[model samples]
Target: MQRFGWLFLTSVGAGATIWCTHFVAMLAYKAGVPVTLDPVLTIISLIVAIGGTGIGFAVATWRQNRLCSIIGGVLVGAAISAMHFTGMAAYRVDGIIEWRWPYVIASLLCAATFSGAAFAALGTATLGRYRIPVGTALLVIAIATLHFVAMTALRITPLRLSTAPLDSTQMHALGLATALVGLVVIATGVFAALIDRWTRSDAMQRLHYMAMNDALTDLPNRAGFQSELARQLGVARATHTRLGFVAIDLDRFKEINDVHGHKAGDDVLTALAHRMRSEMGRHDVVARPGGDEFVAITRFDDRVQLVAFVTRIEAALKAPLSVGPFATSVGASIGIAVYPDDADNAETLANNADLAMYRAKSEGSPAPCYYDAPLDELIRDRRELANDLRRAIDENRLEVHYQVQASIATNEVTGYEALLRWTHPERGSISPSVFIPIAEENGLILPLGEWVMRRACTDAVGWENDLKVAVNVSPVQLAHADLPRLFHQIMLDTGLPPRRLEIELTETAIMADRDHALHVLRQIKALGVGVALDDFGTGYSSLETLRAFPFDKIKLDRLFVSELEGSPETIAIIRAVLALGKSLSIPVLAEGIETGVQLAVLRREGCDEAQGFLLGYPHAVSAAGPSAFIDGPHIEPLPDADDISNAA
Candidate 1:
């Protein structure tokens, strides 16, 4: 409706211009007879011109096609002819008049031809910026030709005596009134055009702002930050100054999001963004690229200055911020890269900073880490290893080794835990710890875990004894794959009974998403597959996890077992976990039993099962057959329970 108003204004202005031109030309005529206009007819003609042209312009605007433009142009020409003829009818002259049919036909034809051409040119994109001017020029030619030719088509002979018409003063007064109205109409059209342009400009600016800013924080988003960084870099280059790029990651932010609702998480992020902005210098820019990650660009003179700035930001971020009903604190792992010192370009500098950030996170460094060239090499090496692992999985070069889990009292092998072992033809054997994290990070764990499960099931099905096979599932795998369905399918494919298969997952995996993990575990349990909480007492909310899931077994982490010799605290935690498991009717399995003393202590503590090198080392399926344990490591006999307690 508003856009149509502009068109209407334009039509009124154009119509008034045409009407005024005709009347002024009449007033300029040098005929000897006196003449005056019919006021009623003049007003009616003005109405016809405005209404007709308005419809024409509206039709043209509604569709930008050649046919519509031509039709619109015809309407406009017809309106002009109507207004001219109607105004001429009001011309009260004492004369005899005659029309030239050929000249009249030629005038009408001229009006239609030029007006159609004008509109058609306006619709042509090839006309470029000259379309409007060209269109206006042709329209003027059409109007002028129509008026002059129509006048030439008429012949008037003056009477010997003139009838009384309006005096010169009255005629001049009427001309002045018409001129005033035409000026008012033109002014109205100009006002509408100006308003429309201003409104459109304001809307465009708003859209640009939305594109460049984060809606929640009203801060510059990644794109906006990059643009600002580029501009700042240009300034720094001109002035020969150094710029620092700091990449900040909120530690355990995913835990926060998973534990609390996303709304609370959003609140936490919003608070952090505000606090970060407040901590920055006026010339510095801070942006939240996505998902608990933020970045800042600041100018610094030296490393010390940059470090001080980063420290301030870290302190500010670590401070408690309010979120909804309560306040929560979050830690930041910041990585810094200096311009010209680290890298010359933006992309390289940003990558260096991100590499450093991951290093800080991995090292658990409280202070910010600066980019070092070695970090880049390490990342490259990891990426190459990831590619190799992908190829290894594809080629079936990976192998599964099994370590026996046995009853504490009888020393009878009850089950075996499947451990993945990778040996690169060139790199020899690779530890699970070294490549497991890489697998998790690079999303290779899903397929790798499936392979291990299927292979373990196939190997276990061929075992002489009906022993269970346990496989470790990473947190990434638990979160992504449909474990129950996969387990069922793998068991069917390998012809292994569900009751003889078990999945060992860490508390950290359950803590990542307790409800979802529990739901999946229940479904797996319904299929008769066992689920054990592996690496117990190492993650947050251990007691809560035990209470939530009805685990078939609890595997005490190797860390606790390793620290049992001198750490009374380790003994107390182990005792408590064992007691809790016993009370819940869930058997406790202690892993990492390298020494006879560790086995004796766990046996004294009433641990149900144990697995480590002391009992049997992990070996390939062929080496780990039923009779393979005949040559296992020798174990020292346990002392009296009271003596063991006294020694501890």
Candidate 2:
């Protein structure tokens, strides 16, 4: 009944109104003889009319079928006929009254036919808004026809005069009282209907609000954001104003969840959401689309204003936040795209902003990046490069180039480090610095890394001299791939001795997942392959890293070698590393030896081995002939700057 509250109110109102009208009409009738109505029968008739009509109204509207409506209407007509007959039975007159059966049957048929037609009309689509009024008018006609026809059936033979004859004035008073009471009952139902309508409207509004908001952060969700953005864009277009869309993605949020728990991550996100909301301007809108991502819309007049606003947001976001008992700070990469400037539509604008955000993430810049045409082109180019790299791995078109690693004291070649080189059929010799990152990002590094290891070992096994071959392993490969098993298989397939092969990795690679990477490295070490830490001083917790892994060699990053002559700090770091290597019984190799002086510095500092342009440029084993002399100074010119970044 609550679900159909309005229908319930309507049924009660209509039934009561029908019963009251019948009594009012009967009371107005001018009968010369005295008459009275039974109180018990009169009350009983009203109850029957209300109950029967309520059931009929509910059934008629319950289904859209015409048959159901007709059945319900007939039931209502029967109730009316029953009520009329029952009221007649209560009437007392000083005469013998009889009914003509034909007239009585006619009245019953008229009531049923007209009432069925009325409800059937209410169920018709064509009736539309006219259904209620039409149904009500038909019901009124049905009631009047039944009452008048049934009255005509009454025939009286006077037996005697009554002792108490009802006077006209007394009858008028009773009729007036009945009419007032009936009006009051009908009025109550109308008031209830009005109350129900107001309550329903309020409930719908609340439901709409819940649907548009985020439960966790109480921020506008994606649907709500899009609606507000479209409205703002319309206004911006009409007024010739600029609107900026800023996309923010939290960095290392996944790590936080992995380390502390998701509950801590949630607390952090909620705190950040509150801070962002507090920082927003009155006209600005901030929303969390999902996860650790947030988007904000701001109206600005110029680039200067936009920059200032973005700077403030960055500062506010970087503030310290509490996660349980501990306090930590999280950084965000923000990207911006402006209306009419970057894009005209919402989808394209959001996409451009996302592209800029990814670029900022790649560059690791503190400042937010704005969408530019070149960024889109760079993304397309990177995608194409990734595709080509995949094909290269499949076709074995990539090459392994080796640069000689020789002892600083003896100038005797100890080994060669294999560097991966890809010469695109069209682009020609794409640098490892550029494509290596792409490979790591797209998961091509696993195959690419394994291929490089296998090829290097195969080439080294065929060499005349017994020399260790070192292969660079990507951090992504080390963390995600089965490195120990892959290397073991490669060594077997290539017929290379495990002791003659070396695996080179950076400190950052081992730090990615210390327990797992160490577990993998230990497994590989058990196979008798030497492990070397490359780019030693460039990563975090250098001393801690050195203590954790038992390394066979430590390669100082080229950055320190380049600064050797100019910076005293560089020389001290080199000496300390070489001394540390000596104490640990490990060899220290310095890379990026461009001039003779850099080489001389390494020799005087007791560095064990070195590899750079001065020793030899990275030439293919097939080009250099694996047995080439190592003592002679290189006559060939040094590699250009583009080749320098490829230290793999």
Best candidate, TM-score: 1
lDDT of each: 0.85, 0.84
lDDT of 2: 0.84
Assess every candidate by TM-score. 0.64, 0.54
RMSD in Å for model 1: 8.0
Off by over 4 Å in 2: 24-32, 38-44, 51-159, 162-212, 259-264, 302-308, 323-328, 339-348, 371-511, 514-648
How do the residues 1-648 of candidate 1 rate in per-residue lDDT, one tens digit apiece? Answer: 777777878888888888888888887775567666788888888888888888888877778678999889888888888888888887776677778989888888888888888988899899999999999999998889989999998787787676565468757866896889778777887797789799899999999998898988778888888899899889889889999999999997887788888888888888888888888887788998777889999887776878778888888888987787877799988888889899898888888898888788878999898888876569757867999999999999999988888889887788889999999888899999999999987889999999999989999898767888899988887776487889899999999999999999988888788888888888889999999989887767467778877899999999999988766788888999899988999999999988777888888789999988888878897655645853433455776676567547
Model 1 residue runs over 4 Å out of place are 1-5, 24-32, 38-48, 63-75, 95-211, 234-240, 255-260, 302-304, 371-431, 441-472, 479-482, 485-518, 527-648
- Residue-wise C-alpha lDDT for candidate 2, range 85-143, written one tens digit per residue: 87777666667889999999999998898999998988888988999899888988889
